[model samples]
Target: MPYHIDLFAVFILLGVVQAIFLSFFFLSRENRKNDVNFFQGLMLLSMAACILEIFLMYTGYIVDCLFLVDFSEPFALAIGPSFYLMIRSLIHGSVSRKMQLVHYIFPVVYFFLLIPFLIQSNDFKYNSWVYAYHPNLPFRDVSVGYDPRWLWVTDHHTLMSLVSIGIYFLFGLVEVIRAFKEKRESFFAPVHSVLKKLRSGILHMTSATVIIFVVKYLNIDDTGDHLFAAYISFTIYLTSFNVISHSGFFRQVALSEPQKYKSSGVTADAQKELLDKLAMLMTRDKPFLQSGFSLPELAGKLNTTVHVLSQVINDGLGKSFFEMVAEYRVEEAKRLLKEQPHVKVEEIAEQVGYNSKSSFNTAFKKISGKTPSEFRSA
Candidate 1:
């Protein structure tokens, strides 16, 4: 078998390489400890596998390696579930084990269904590939010594792939919408700008996948697969660009000033008054208990600007806004840990405005010199 390469193949191979790198980056020991990173890494890996298979087929290299034919079908099936899990982890901080099992059922079943094809002879697999891609070339009659009905799922693999991804796409979109609604913020609001961008990216990627699959299905063969592969490459490039742009590596650093707030016109008396009001609010209302509580929201409640509130927190309280909030939260966690010893540490984390236990533990240890468990045990 002869291998072929072209500009399209080269472009797609570049994407494949980048996707694989990103997958490993996210799955690295430092990153994969976070559930969001774990799921996102799995999604990227699945996508990279699918794109790699497409690249090999497009370049006519799969003909020489018949055993690798259609090997990415399970990975393709996995893409949707991983994507949905990543979104869920992002919004909720972690996915339950049951939810992960439920989401992966289809991929697991699809892999089992492909066992027959996977075990077929090289002649059979080669004919399958040739029939799908090189239709104009000479044909070879081969048999797998079994009824083709055993592989009915593979016969409709394209439709199944679309349906799988489409369903998960809906699931992910609904999750995003629900998160926005729960926050009581409009889609146009800046409070959820991160989630808004995530939703936008997922929407664009899913929409493009649907369009590409529809076109591939209509083409009735692997002829238009190069286009699908190219689209995947474009998405990979877009993802990489987004990551690099937001990584802050290229951002310019500003010089430190001796007196950062010297120009602030807030009088000493006004600062004392603002500090009193903030203290009252923190003690009486405990706005920090709200998981989505933010500096802007606190400013709104206190009838002051965000900058002023930040200044008051930093200068008057001698801590940054987040550090102040974390102190309050950790204090609350300490109370809960002592009074409700039977309650799980995870529950305490949530009650104290933490989205994940790891963050709660870090903040607790930072402020109290003990983890929540250690504090509770003591």
Candidate 2:
């Protein structure tokens, strides 16, 4: 068989490369600890695999490697579940192991069902591919020892895939909706911009996939798969562009500011020491409990310059000085709310160093996802 290549094939090949790269990028050890990254990595890998198979078949490359034909069918089933799980992880921090198992069962079963066809002779698989994708091509005569009942499943795979993806898309949409409702946030809300983008991206990608599948199947059955593959490539490119743009890597850096604390003179050792001192101060003295406690006063207590203290809190702890104080205050407030249930919310707020109840309510809700009254009542 002769090889075929075109601009469409090239586009798809590039998308496959990028999708695989991003899959590994997200799955890398540095990012694996994050549940969202882990599931997104899995989703990307599944998408890359499905697109790669489509690319090869669409470009006639599979003619040279018939044994690899249809290898990505099972992975196609995984795309929906992985995407759903990614959304779940984003909203809930992590998906339960049992839920993961349940979601993956369909893909696992499909893989098992595909094994028979996968092990068939090259001629058998080639004829199968030709029947589905290239009906004009001459079919080679081949004999199979037994009937592969799984062909029934493969016969309706397009519809099955569409339904599978649609079901999971609904699941993911519901999950996002529930999360937003519970958090009192909306997709249009200015807060949680990162999460909003993520949710919106997932929905758009999944919905686009569904539409592409429907159009492809309706217009040209399996032969129009390249169109679907092309869309997947476009989705991958869009995802990559979004990731880079949102990463802030290209944000303008002010020449005058240079680094955040280039002149602070705080060495790594001193930063760690300051962080330790800050932690000890919070634990031992609970200075955040003092109403109107100021950063300068905390710096004075730590015997460090305000700039150095700010750097310590921001760099070493990954939060601003005020954010760290707020966290401490909220934690103390929670303890008081739980242990001293009879205490009024105002008294608890005052005890946690907030001069006003409204300010305390805001901080408590921001950190704990609930107001003091709601938390106490729960």
- Tell me how many clashing residue pairs each candidate has: 0, 0
Q: Highest TM-score among the candidates is held by which one?
A: 2
Query: Residue 171 in candidate 2 has what lDDT?
Result: 87
Deviation of model 2 at 310, angstroms: 11
Local accuracy of candidate 2 as per-residue lDDT tens digits, 1-378: 576788889999999999999999889885665667788898889889988888888878788889888888878888889888888766555677899999999889988888887888999989878887778899999999886544788656666777788788888888877867765776666255435655676567666767676776586657777777888888889889876755534555566875875355566555764565567568878989998799988876665567777877887989987899999999999999999999899999999999999999999999999999999999
Please report, as a residue range, the 10-residue window in candidate 1 with the lowest summed lDDT: 248-257
TM-scores, one per candidate: 0.68, 0.70
Question: Model 1 clash pairs?
Answer: none
State each model's C-alpha RMSD to the native.
Answer: 12.0, 10.3
Q: Report the number of backbone clashes for model 2.
A: 0
- Candidate 2's C-alpha lDDT? 0.80
On a 0 to 1 TM-score scale, where does candidate 2 land against the true structure?
A: 0.70
